[model samples]
Target: MAAIYQVDSFTKLPFSGNPAGVYISDVEQDYETCIKIAREMNLSETAFPVRTTDDNHYRLRWFTPTTEVPMCGHATLATSWVHFTELGIDGDIYYETLSGQLKVSRIGDDLKMDFPSELPFRIDLDQSIGEALDCNGMAYYSTGTRKLLFEISDRKKLEGLHPDFSKMEKLSVGVPLRGLIVTCKGDGEFDFFSRYFAPWVGINEDPVTGSAHTVLGPFWSERLGKDKLRAYQASQRGGEIRLEILDGNRISIIGNAVTVIRGQMLV
Candidate 1:
């Protein structure tokens, strides 16, 4: 039997964050087995801790319902919670992942993570993106994700968007990554807020994506004048990250994780 741990990462509340399942094992598990478990769990993402390197560090991997991914932030937070809170695992933890080493620390009730920043580049977006979205936007950029980031005038127009998913899928054929539509001036405490949709990655929408903040935190932190600011992901079940931009290459994102479900499964 494998122990299954459900953790809500990047938020303080239970039903208002990105929920991930963490499975811990004493032995190394195959990729196919991990993918099968992820598909069965049917969450946006699942994490597997294959080994404990020391009291404070472990090796981890993340998988979506559709495929195994290189990196996952929210799941990393969730995994840290399972280690420190549930299983009595403690101290500063280091995760060796496909994207490299990730350092996580415990701060009172919240977990803080120092993640690498992915500074976005200005790229040319094709007309197909606009056509597929069925909206006329002024600017577009790509972050190597399937989604093209679209610039718009106001929140009203931004919120009124109803993308043609079928059209988007068809237009995605020469596209770098899925498409993301964002506009400034939304009605929120944070200077800006965003909604993420990546049907191309097999997730139609992510409740609260910590990875997206790699781009977002830097972009907003520069624009908003303060290194520390509040970020709200406007989803049906939303989440928050207290972000602090450090220098140019590093950023600190803070949030809390709650353990929702814990059980063991036959593998």
Candidate 2:
């Protein structure tokens, strides 16, 4: 039996941030089992970390209820948190995932993740997207994460705007989009503000998305003229993300996570 846990990423409190299922096992988990467990967990994404010969290194995979994703930040953070705090793993943890080799280092209570940066390319706006989101802004597409980026004019609009999710879903499938990021410049303590929606991937609204910030980090860095910035995800269950733009087209995401649930998978 493997040990399974539920963790809230990017927040210290339970039921905040983004919740992800973490499955820790020594034996290899197959594709069918991964999906089954992911569906059972029913979080935005689940992290399955299978140990390799190296104690600190793992082969990690992430799955949504409906499909596997190439990258997932919050789940990765949850998995590393479990390893570092719960299991007493030491030093920097390494993950061999669909996004290539990634590393996480513990910084006191916070964890910093070395992730690949995804620079978004500007694309012509789709009118249907405006109808779905009920707002209009610049549109960009990221090849690395397959997330569509939209920059609205104000934070209030970004926070207050409600989308017709059904129409949003239709647009995502028809346009073949994986997720949508609605973002704007923060007017207060945070440097930027954003929200994530991905009905096409079984997540209607992710509370705090680390993967979305891969695109957000660079998008803001260029405009803000700063390598390091603070960001807030304005979901109902909100969360904060600290970002640093790195050389070689990479990014660093920093946050804390709390283990909200723990149990053994008996099967």
Candidate 3:
């Protein structure tokens, strides 16, 4: 049996943010077991944290319903929330992940995650992809994570996007990446607005993605000419993120999470 918690990350209210499964245990589960658990949970991502040599440090791994990923922001925030609120652990917590060492700390009511920034490089916008996204002539870029990022001029266009998931999946197959980020300039309270789609990774649309903002922070910083910005993910279940660009290609992502469900997974 394993303790499983369903947490809503990136929002203070429930059902408005990304929900992730967090599994906390002293023993590290096998790869197949983790995959199975993730499949059973069937969320966008599930996190497994196992204790390491240091009490404050742990090894973290993230999994989608279909595959494992190197990094995941919402799930990591959920993990930290579980540790802080459920397990009575506080202060800074370190995680060893495939993306390398990461840190999360509590600042007031929000948990601030120190993540490596990913600056995007310009790429030619493909016509087929534009057609699939229903927006053409959008600027396209790629990051080290291999996710495709594009920008639209109108926030309404970005919000009204109804991408063809099947077309997106076919186009992304065998491309070493599955996620696409579509962003636009914000209107009122937000500096920018965006959405994420990753049909190839078994997620059609992520409600609020923290990992995507690692690239967005730098990409928008250069365009908006600000080091700190507030972003909004315009999904059906909307969420917000506070971003701060740091030196050495690092970014601080700040958001709030709430544990919505707690149960024991009997396996």
Task: Look at candidate 3 and give me any clashing residue pairs.
Answer: none
Residue 165 miss distance in model 1 (angstroms): 2.2
Candidate 1, position 48, lDDT: 91
Residue-wise lDDT of candidate 3 within 103-132, one digit each (tens)? 999988899999998888766656767888
- Checking candidate 1 for backbone clashes, the offending pairs are 145-177, 146-177, 146-178, 147-177, 147-178, 147-179, 148-179
lDDT of each: 0.75, 0.91, 0.90
Better of 1 and 2 by TM-score: 2
Taking the tens digit of each residue's C-alpha lDDT, what string does model 2 give over 30-88? 88889899999989899999888886889999999889899999999999999998999
How would the candidate models be sorted by lDDT, starting from the highest?
2, 3, 1
lDDT of 1 at 62: 91
**Highest lDDT: which candidate?**
2
Displacement of the residue 229 alpha carbon in candidate 3, Å:
0.4
TM-score of each: 0.89, 0.97, 0.96
TM-score between model 1 and native: 0.89
